[model samples]
Target: MLEKIFKWILTIVGFALGYAATEIAKNWGFINSIIGTSNIYRIGFISIAIILFGIIFYIVSPFIIKLIFKLTGFLESGIQKIPTNDIILSVLGLIIGLLIANLLITPFARFLAGNTILSIVGSTLTLVVNIVFATLGVNITLKKKDDLYNVFTFLRRFSKDKKSKADSKLGISQPKILDTSVIIDGRILDILKTGFLEGPIMIPSFVLEELRHIADSSDNLKRARGRRGLDILNLMQKELMLPIEVVERDFENIQEVDSKLLKLCQIYNGKIITNDFNLNKVAEVQGVPVLNINELANAVKPIVIPGEEMNIHIIKDGKEAGQGVAYLDDGTMIVVEGGRRHVGEVVDVVVTSVLQTAAGRMIFAKLKSAS
Candidate 1:
């Protein structure tokens, strides 16, 4: 039904174009002579032209409809995905652009009054100018929106009282943005529950969308991981103590989630909470602060110095001969020398040395007797 209506509208447009073409053709002396000064012939010429154009448009309407549908779908999704603040800015930009175009076209409009061809040219130029200016307005407005927000935020800090001042001093004027890795790691929830982290935590809409995608994946492990992340997010929002500010911040230009996290950090002047080692390194290089859960876990782990004796089960053999691998309660790997034969049995070992790396802590130990 809509397609038919569109086709009819196109046919009417073609009819109008045919009549306008006739008016323009009158400027050509040859066209006047060929059609004669008779109204009958002139009307006949326009009638044929209108019929031809209307038929042509009717024939091509299906293809045009497809293109229109594609464009509409793309634009609809884009507009829906864009935050409301951005949409308001875009509309303001469009209005400003139209105002500028109206002012600039005023003089040109006068010159185009007496001539149909000139009027058409003037209208086309007006349309082009409107489009160019509107596009420029939108780009400029969106690009400067962050600066504008910062200005407002700065002013707000001055106007609000002591609590606001305290919040600013705490380096949380902007909420800490959570990354997919940290959310999936699930340790952040426990850390938040401890009441150490202050201020509201931000979860981007894109990260949640990514989790949903993962949750819908065919792979069992990925699906489970994604579901777990979602569940953790649910708990944080409903049951956790800290204020959860789930924001819809998104960067359309950035591809990887990690890169988006970095971009978001830059935008909000906020830190990232993540457990991803590579992301942590990248954030450091980018001058973005990061709270790495893995690093935090390692930092809080029980300190074990050399020559410390502890009982550990030799669950497996290490790479070298006569070495058995055990694990601390927190999953720290401990390699025990001369204990490979004791695999599947609990044994005592002395901590020979403790190694720490970006991944976590490792322990190299010798049997208590050998030590």
Candidate 2:
């Protein structure tokens, strides 16, 4: 019913335009004078032209609209790699700009009236101007709506990256997806405290649900950790003012949380933030980028070399006999040979070897000779 109404409106508009065009042609003596056209012939000709053009444009309009839809779909699909919130804000800006243009611009243009052709063309141009301003305003707003947190993040990475080369100075920043383990472990709190982590920290709604489940768990330890995670999240949002947005994004038909995480990371070209060793390894296998807290901590740890003597207190016994375990300031584990007797005491040990793994660094050492 609505379509038929639109068609009738179009038909009426077409007839008016066709009658107007014929009148103009006659007044201008373009065609009727050349053929000695009668009044009857002129009326018939004008009516036939009006009916044909209206029918053609109306018939082809649906196809035109479908083509436009396809083009918009292609553009949207391509930009899906960008954050959804940013896209929404951009559209909002576009609407606001169009509204302002309609109210302010069109009327002002109409106030500057002109002659027949000039007036018609000026009105047409005014409509075009409104559309152009709307589009421009939206695009400008979107391009400039830089999230402060995300910007700082890129700056830190960009500074580190500058050490490599002059040409590889910096580029576009990638999205940072916060994983459940990282949130629960609460190391991200400290990282954010330092104001180094850059880019918007996205907490997937599913991840938050998982955190809530952990908080409500039967196990006391898990419950405590879950609550702590929640506290840290609030602190980050309220105190630190970090943009911790929870997106209601999910991978339909996928049940496994890990699988969904990897899929989301791939979809957004985002890096996963997690302390899970297995997830890190799996991400590597799948070629998805990951920002492992363990890896970052390890990178910033003091370098321990073989044959270097260090003073460390033995905290506990290793699984093997006569072996004690110690930790560096950064929490990298060191296995000390023949140091079980030194438990609860500080001892100098000669570093024997260093093992670097996805989890962290491990140091092996033997007790130094007693002076």
Q: TM-score of the candidate numbered 1?
A: 0.57
* lDDT tens per residue, model 2, 1-371: 65566666666676777777767777766586653657787768788778876777677656655676689899988887666656676787788888877877666567656577767777887789788878887887777665632454456445544533542356545678998899888888889878887767888888888889999999999999899888888877887656677888975546878888987876666789998888999988766778888778888988978889899999999999999999987788999999899899998889999999866789999989742
Clashing pairs in 2: 150-199, 153-198
* Clash number for each model: 0, 2
Per-candidate RMSD vs. true structure? 11.1, 15.1
Tens-digit lDDT string for candidate 1 (247-331): 7777765689888877777666677998887998988775677898877898988889998889989899899988899998989
> TM-score, each model?
0.57, 0.52
Please, what is the whole-model Cα lDDT of each candidate in the order they appear?
0.85, 0.79
